[model samples]
Structure formats: structure tokens, C-alpha cells
Target: MNPDNREWERVDEKMILVMRLTGAGKSYFIQQLTGMNVSAGHELKVHILYLANFVAGTEKCQVIQTSIGNTDFAIMDTPGFDGTTRSDAEILKVITEQLSIIRLGYNLKGIVYLHRITDNRMGGSAMRSLDIFEKLVGEDALSNVVLATTMWGNVVDIAAANRRDSELREEYWGSMRRRGSTATRFDGTRESARAIVEQLLGKKAVVLKVQEELVDREMSLNQTAAGVLLELEVYAEAEQIRKRLEQLESELKYEKDSNKRLEVKRSQRRNAKAFSQCAEDKKTMKSKPGVEVKGKLKKWAESGGKIGLQALQGLAAIVSISFGIAGFILGAGF
Candidate 1:
């Protein structure tokens, strides 16, 4: 658990749960929305983890107070479920515990889930996370949820992003919208974050599915739906790694090619590491008790290949040659 997590623990301030995958601007959004810097002479400030350039910046949960309209509200910032350093089980355990504690004290406005606008597709990890989120929120309170796409400034083509947004509205996130989850954009600005929060201010307060299950219903991790789903995923990963290892072993038995065997052996090693991690996670899940969840740039240097770079280079050569010839002919005529 974050040591400073409950430092600002109070009941009066209304709470909003903001979540996103790592590097999806979850912290940045919260930091901007609160408009409070670290110890800049403000009563409420968000503490951000200092990370190196290569690694994703955020690593923990921050619960802080920021006023929206005339009322002061508490915003609980969460780390991504797929974040590095901690296992998903550990992360979820800490988050659900903290949320449940807060829920007991005060009313929670709703959940706000953010996604990257530049992401071309909602991949497997994201989809699975969404499934767990649904189980966490439950069907009844899902209408209070907001599935907002963010980082609009990063995308060069607004039209392309709009098309993807429409698809999310119609197909990808269509079911969520139908169930009452509103789709919006963060626009990567403080104004956008405030606007979104304003809409949620003074809204209905509902108990999260996980909170009700664990706190009210007193359900164990295994008994809750989201917890069960995560356990199954851990088991599935282990099973998948085991099957691949068996397949590689069988292939090595019949194969005479030394190079191929070496490749398979290396693959087995990596899968072995992943399997070991998965097994440990499964153990943690069984032991712990929280039911909860959850680019196209055309530069040859970026392309790292001769195809696009060479294609552009070739096209440039052709254009140059044609222009050169035209200039010569025109000069001769003159």
C-alpha cells in the first residue's frame, strides 16, 4: 500500500475514481485537474513518482482533494493494472482496499476510465481489463461510468481519430454506452479535465460492485466475479506456457537441426520465466482477498527499414529527375 495513500484521508470531500493504463496520461490528467503542484504552498498537492525517461512515469495511488465548482472533491488516482514493478493482483488488492475504506467514509461520484486517443485499436490486454472493470462496477452502476478517450493533441489527424471514436461509440464501446457509460474526450488539457469533472459533480453516488461484494456481502476473492476472472487468467497464462514448453520439447526430440533446437531452447527459457511469474501471481491471488479489476509515422529513420525510407527516397529521386529534365527543357526553349 502507498504510505501516503491515507495521509489526506477524510470523509467530507466527494470522491472521483480516475483510472487508465500506464503511460495513458492518468497522473498527468489528475495533476492538471487539481491545479496543485508539489508543495507550492497549497493545502492539497499530488505526489508523483519520479521515474527515468525510458520507464513509465507513475507507480502508485494518490488520493488528493481538489475543488470543482463551489465544492471540494477528493480524487483517487490509481496505477494501471498492467503496470510494471507490481503484480496485477497486488495492485488491485491495494486499490480495492483503499476504495472500500473511502467508500465507507464518504460518497463516490463515479469512475472515469481514460484511454489514449492515438491508439489505433483496443488490443487484448485493454479488452480483458474492460471486462474486469465491468465486473467491478456491476451492471446497475455502469451508467455513472465515463469511458473517455484522451491525448487528442498527440494525434496529427483529427479526422482519423474521430473515425475511431465513432467506432468506439457504435461498436467497440457501444455496449458500454448502452449500459450508461458515457464516451468523451480529455483533449489533453486542464479545461477538458475540469469540464468532464464538472459534469460528474453532484451526480448520484453509487457503491462499486467490488465494494458491495467485499464490504457489504463479505465475499472472498475467489467468490467475487472479478477476482475469479483474474485467477483464471493467471492459470491460463501458466497453462499456455506449459503447453508451449511441451510442444517445443516434442519438436526438439524429432528435429536434427542444431540451430532450430537452439532457438526453441531460448524460447523455452523465456516462457519458463513468464510461467514462473504467473505461478507466483496465482499464489498471491489465492492468498489475497480483494475482488476488483481493472502509431503511423512516415519517417524512414523511424521506419527502421529500406522499404518506406527507400520508397520515399526513390519517389523523391524520380520527382527530382523529372523536375531537373523539365527545367533543362524550359531553359533550352528560353
Candidate 2:
């Protein structure tokens, strides 16, 4: 691919900006998305720059640039770690700087707000700051606002954690909507993070698999394309019908198995009740001798309990045979 004419430069067609709070996996996110490896191990000493265009007697607009991929991408790393620099003041300064850039003919593309997945809870401070930033940046800027939740690898239950991340996105997006700020979720796993990058690039991005974690399966082009087409109610009706049929088959198999289990349980329960009744009859026979035994046997015979009581009755026949043999041998030997 020729570097100059590459579609990759489309990122530069607009003034793209990434605004993230401190330690929100911004560095890792940038590395994964751009395939750029910085600060790998040795201290090569890289410097990030924030260049300001001066107006009158004061510095007005500033552009923060970081080197990622073959491109020099502009980004704003907010909530600086300087002890004296408060988060509110840094955000205020960045807003002022961006406004100055807008006046000086720089068009803004979008903003990505980096959020840490390590903290399951969103800080009120961050929420309040986002509100202020959105109000200053205007509601159109919300289209540019992306809430990136990072560090998914540390989660124990990946599926549950992902669900939590999704819930958080819904809440965050709803909050943004309430403030007239549009936002989307950028949960930084290999799959989702790449998807978000592709959306931002406005094209299906070619992804090089670096490491696989948490992604259950890799979806194919045909599947994804088909899915997207289906969303538009396009010409994929046949494929949808096939998928529904497969789902119905699976459901039918499940119901069949469930019914079989219910029948087995019912049979077992009936046999158990019959066995208990037989034991009670035996106890009555011991207490009341011949009369109770005859009455009880007659009742059981009349009640259609024959098949159910067959197992217990077979044991009784064995006992009677053993007793008859004992009696005959004793009489002959004596």
C-alpha cells in the first residue's frame, strides 16, 4: 500500500482527538488499536507534545499529538498528574485551548473519553466533569464522545464482567443522553476495541490478531455482512429462515428430553408410594395376623395396585419358598 494515497489518511481528513483521564489504559488502547509498540521495555524516552497557537499576547489553541502507527495522531491526555494541577482546571484549560483552535480554523472531529474498567463504579467527579465538558463542547460533540472502558483482562468472570461493562455503557450513555450528549461503549477487549476503531475509521478495518482473550469465537466476514444486511431487512430472508428453523429444532429436542425426565420421575414416585403401602400392610399382618393380612391383600388386589406392588410381592414369594424348603428338610432329617 502506498503510504500517501492510503485510506488510512482519512483519519486526518478530520481533526481527530482523544481526550482521556489519567491511567485509563489510554496507552494500551492506543497501542492495540494502532499496532504501535511504545515503552515496551527499555527506556527509549518518548515525549508527548502539546503545541499551542499563540493569539495576541496569550497562547490560545493547542493541539496534543502522539505518534501511533505511521500517523501523528492528536490526543488530549486530561487530568494531568501534576500535584498543583486540578482535574477541573486541566479540563477548563483544554476547553479553552480547543475553542481557540476552532477560532483559528481547526475543525474538531471527535472525542473519546477513556474510562477505567478496574473501577466498576463511575466517579461522581468524572460524571460532573463530563457534564461540564459536554455543555462547553456542545451536543454535537456528543456524537464524538466515546466512553472507553478498559482493562477487561483482569476480570475473573469474563462473561459476567462483560455484562457489567455493557450495563455501565447503557447507564453512561443514558446519562449522556439526559445531558444531550451522544455516546457509545468502547469496552477495550481485543474484539470490541477493534470494532470501535473500525467504526471510527468509517470502514471495515483489517485486524491482525495479536492475542485472544475473552472472545468466545471469531465471527467471519460473511456472518458479519449477513448480520448487517439483516438489520436493514434486506435480501437475506432465506438465511434468516434457515437460522430460525435450526433454533426450532434445538427447542424441540430440549422439550423432548424434558418430557422424558418428567415421565421417569412420575413412574418412580408411583413405585415409591406403592412400596410404602406394602410395608404398612406387612406391619398390619404382624399386628393382626390372618384377618388383617387377608383384608389388606384383598384391598390391594382390588385397587389396581398389582403392577406397582409387583417388586415387593416378588420378595415375599422368595421368602415363602425359603421357608417351605426349610420345613421339608427339617421334617425329613428328624
Candidate 3:
């Protein structure tokens, strides 16, 4: 039997995507919801490396079919945005591949984005994941998104947790909540998990931005809205690292102590390695070919050369790799 046929064996099942950073309790939530013995690791490295190991007798990005109160669901336990073993670009590629499969005939009822309440602050990785998620879903489908915070049981200070929760709604997740996306808590119980799933039970199936861009618009991964956002972030980080290297170079020259000078050299080496990785990530982003911009030079000429020097350089790179110029414009939105 073909794998695609096996996937759609039950056409009536409602599809849901459960996504978050690693160790945010996605697998545990699924285990609670479906009564499946999916492994939800407590250790950070274990969770990052193996959270998606066992689910519905399948591996990563596979659907776990289950039922709750007569409504059958095919829940997707997605890989985390920050995986120790996979780059963000690779993780996005895996997710898009699964989305492509889901688009074949399934209805993606909703998305559950999980966050750890124990986290003291919204770090760069978390913010990047959220940004990519927003671009992937687009503003039009915000109503179908549920921002869920988990790991309440592990929190020591209830007051602090409550304050953080408020901060999430008012500060971090403010825009998403105001735009029809809701905020909720998952208390690590079957009932709580069921309630979260039930919230999306009646929502109409949504066509995510990535789905439209990748499938309907025939855009490449690099040219998609989310992809462009990731690229811009990489470029920005690389630029920051470049500046840091220059600062470290100056510090190393002026340092009198041997120990301090060694530390500066170490910092320089680290920044250089990070900058090189960013460049490699950029290359990976533009590797896959998709819809090409017909008359690419003509479009660039018509833009009156006003897209800025940075955007023009980006356009040059895209044209060299046969990607569309739309990616640069998409970056402007961020």
C-alpha cells in the first residue's frame, strides 16, 4: 500500500498540529490527550533528541490518530523549532513536507503552540520560533491559533508564574491575542488537554500562509514568507557577530593580562565560527529551486533601484540561485 493512501485511510479525521520549542511538553500533552505512551523526556537533551520517538507506532512528523467524544482526530506531533540535532531550516523543511502531505485532502482544524511557564524570559530562539510561526500562519488565520503555556506543575513560585502569564498576554503574545488568537494554560492533565483540543473542534479548516505560498503560489522554501524571515534573521545575526568580532579584535590588542587576551581570542574564534554557520545556513536556504521570477532583471529595473543596497544584495543572491525577488520584500514586513 502507498504511504499517502495509508495516511488518508480515514478521511473523516480532523487534523491538528501540536508545535513548540523542545521540552515544552508537546509529547506529554499528546500522551495525555490520546492515552498513548509517547515518551516525554524530562532531561533537556533527551527531550530535544527523542521526544518524537514513539507515537502511534510512527516516528517524527507522523500523525497520531485518536478519538475524543465522537470527533476523530489525526494529531501531528511536530519536531521542535529548536532541535539540538537539526537546524531551524531543516526543521521547517520537515514541517513543510508534512504540511504538503496534509494538504492533499485533510482539514487542518487548528494549531497549538506551547510555551514553558518556567522560562524566566522570552529568549531569542523562542522569539524567532514565534516570528517564523506568525509568518507561516499569516494574520488571516490567527483565529485558529492557540497559544498554550505548559509546565505549571514544575513552577515553584505561583505568583511569579502568574506574573509571567500576564506578561505573555500583555507583552510577548499581545499582538497575537488581540488579533483573535487565544491564550490558555495546560495543567498537565487529561481533562486540561482535552479542553485545549476541544477549543479547535468547531473552527473551520485554515489554509496557512506557507501552504498557500508553497503549494498554491508555487513558491520555493527560500521564497516563502517564513523562509525569508529566517533568512533575514540569519543575516542580521551574522552582521551582529561581525561587529562583535571587530570589538573583540580591538579588545585583544589593548589587553595587558595574558589571561584576558586569551579570553578575547576565544571569543573571536567563537564569533567567527557562528558567522560561518550563518553563511552556510543562507546557502541551505537558497539551495532548493522553486518558482522562478520571470524577467527577473526587468522587475529589478522597474523597482527604481529603491529596495535598498541590502535588499539589492539579497536580490542578487536570489537571482544567482534562481529564487524569486519577493523574499526581499517579505523581509520588509519584519
Candidate 4:
């Protein structure tokens, strides 16, 4: 059977996207909502690198069709922005391709972005994922977004969790909340999952920014808002590494002890390797469609050849990518 024709047969069904960082309970939540026998576990394992293929049971996007209170909708399970085995660019390509397929038959009714409430602090990967998500949704579709916090049952310290929740709303999620995005909790229950889905059942389906950019405007993936944000993030990381290498060089020149000097030299070599990797990543990005290398170089030169610290102040932490599913859901893979 033709997949496109099969999708077209379900034209009346509303579409919803489930997105977040790895280990954020996306598959587990979908299992609760659709009662699918999806793979889910509490402990993140090293072998579980890719969410879409290993966890969600398919490399291509899978739409699990289910009815919620007489309303038939399809929930699309997506790969995380921080996949251990996949670059953000590769993941974005997969997502945008699937989205383009869905655009032929249906519009997105809502998006559910899950976060771990148990996390005391948001890491760099989480922050970068959130930034890219916002750009993909655009300001106009903020009302259709649900910022759902998961793993509430795992929190032993209720007060600290609440404080973290408040901090997320006030600092990280403030602008989104003010612009009509909602904050909710997922308590690892079927009822809670249904309730979250119910919130979007009545909302009017709208085209997401990515859909508009890729399908409507016919723009290349590298030219979209989310793509630009990812590029800037990569550039910022490279600049920071460059600055650190310069500092290490200065410190090595003034060091008097041989042991300290050896340590500094070791650090320099490590930083140099990392900088080389970043340069390769930039080359990959530039090779994508619609990226003009000369134009980007000109822009970099115009900005005094340095990325502003203010642009990426809190994103200095190294990303530690992991993947897992909550144990509350079914333990078998689909």
C-alpha cells in the first residue's frame, strides 16, 4: 500500500507531535495515551542511543492513530533533539521530512513538549532543545503548545520540585507562558495523560512555523528559523572553545612549574581536538541546502569576528546525551 495514500485516508484526523530531549518520557506518555506496547524503562542505558528507531520502533516517523473521547487523532512520536548517535541537523532533517508528508493531509492540532521535573537544573542540551522548539512552533502557534513536566512521582523533595517548577516558569518558560503556552504536570498515569491530550482536543489546528517554512514557502531546511538557531548555537560553541584555547596559551607562557605546564599542554591538545570537531560540524552545516558560506563568513566578520557572550551565556555546560523510557508504561517494544 502506498503510505501517502494511506495517510490521505485519515484526512479528518487531527495530528499532534510529541517532542523533548531524550529520556523525557515521550514514548511512555504515548503508550499511556494510545495504549501501545512501546518500549519504556526508568534507567537510561548506553545502548539506547536513538529514540525514534530504538524506542519508538521505527526510523521513519510513526503515527499511532487513536480516539480520545470520540475525537480521532494521530500522535506522531519524534526523535529527541539530543540523540547520542545523531546530530541535531540529521534529526531535524528526519522530522521536517515527516512533517512535510503529514502536511499533505492534516495540520497539527497541538504539540506536547515533556520535561523532567526531577531535574534540579536545566542543562545545556535542554536549553538548546527548548530554543529550537520555540522557533519551530513560532509565536503565532504558542497557544497550541503544552509544556508538560514529567517524572513528578520520582521527586522525593516536593518543595524543591515546586521551586524548580516556579523557576522554570519565571525564568526559562516565562515568555512562552505569557504568550499563551500552558504549563502542566504528567503524574505517570493514564488519567493524567488523557487530561493533557484533552486540553488540545478543542483547539483549532494550525500550521507550525516549520511546516510553513518547508512546505508553504518551499524554503530549504538550512534556511528555516529552527535551522538558523541551530547554526548560531554551533557557531557560539566554536567561538567559546577558541577563546578558551587562547586563555590556555597565555597561562602556559607564564607557568613556572613543569607539572603545571604539562597539564596545561594536555588541556590545550584536548581543546584543539574539540575545536577541530566543531569546525567539521560547521562544514557539514554549510554543505546543507541554502547555506551560503561566503555570506556567513561576511556576517561573521561584520560581527567583529566574535560571538557575543550574551547570546549564549548559560549554555556553557557540556552536553551528556542519554535515553530511557519510564517504567510505568509497558515494558515491551512495539
- Which prediction has the highest lDDT against the true structure? 3
Q: For residues 290-327, could you state the per-residue lDDT of candidate 4 as single tens digits?
A: 12222332344365543221111111111111112221
Q: Report the Cα lDDT for candidate 1.
A: 0.63
- The digit string of per-residue lDDT tens for model 1 on 134-245 reads 8888888787788888888899998999998898788878888998888998886778888788667757877788777766665666567788988887788889989998
Per-residue C-alpha lDDT of model 2 across residues 116-184, encoded as one tens digit per residue: 666666676556545444444454344545566667666777777677677666776566656543345
* Distance from true location, Cα of 40 in model 2, Å: 12
Q: Order of all candidates by TM-score, from best down to worst?
A: 1, 3, 4, 2
What's the TM-score of every candidate structure? Answer: 0.70, 0.42, 0.68, 0.67
Cα lDDT computed for each candidate against the true fold: 0.63, 0.38, 0.69, 0.68
- Enumerate residue pairs that collide in model 3: none
Model 2 CA deviation exceeding 4 Å by range: 1-13, 39-73, 80-84, 175-195, 201-334
Ranked candidates, highest lDDT first:
3, 4, 1, 2
Give me the runs in candidate 1 sitting further than 4 Å from their true place.
1-10, 37-59, 246-269, 288-334
Candidate 3: tens digits of C-alpha lDDT, residues 61-179: 53555567666666766777787765676667667755644543467898999999999999998998898888988988899999999999999999999999999989989999899
- Deviation in angstroms for 10 in model 2? 17
